[model samples]
Target: MTHTITGSAKLLARVRRIKGQAAALEGSLGEGTECMAVLQQIAAIRGAVNGLMLEVLEGHIREHLGPDASAAQRAEDTEAVVAALRSYLK
Candidate 1:
């Protein structure tokens, strides 16, 4: 897909950043880092993952329903996406 091609670099960068965060978390644990610090790192990783999800969802919506789509269609699509994400992330 054009969205995938166009967004590959950005998405890969995010993935790499997430990997780095995971490595840091691992290293911190090895060094006996505090629990609070580890929790913060986990929270950052969750936020990054959510951001990636948003980007992919935006691309999916754009590709499937073009900008000229009706308002009701857009609303329905958005609701479905939100519901799916909420269910998945929980």
Candidate 2:
């Protein structure tokens, strides 16, 4: 819980890389790239986004929901995670 990505250089780097990939995907689409090429770019962006989400989520779980967590804290964390998953699914 005390640990956060606010000062994490590596996590910040991941965000920047994801931003670059998204830009590349948009550029490819705007350039009228072929279907397969554009699809590849889209796939790359999706994978990058998923990777970022997983890194953050895993950290949250390990830090905030570990054995030291109280029952209320575990419930809160579980609800938050479920909400995030529902949103992502939609």
lDDT scores in order: 0.87, 0.84
Which residue pairs clash within candidate 2?
Answer: none
Candidate 2 lDDT for residue 45: 81
TM-score of 2: 0.88
Q: All predictions: root-mean-square deviation over Cα?
A: 3.1, 1.6
Q: Highest TM-score, which number?
A: 2
lDDT of 1 by residue, 27-69 (tens): 9999999999999999999899888888888897897567876
Candidate 2, poorest ten consecutive residues by summed lDDT: 1-10
How many clashing residue pairs, candidate 2?
Answer: 0
lDDT of 1: 0.87
Model 2 per-residue lDDT tens digits across residues 1-90: 445545378678888998998898889888988999988888888898888788888888887789988999999999998999899878
- For candidate 2, the lDDT comes to 0.84
What are the runs in model 2 whose C-alpha is more than 4 Å off? none
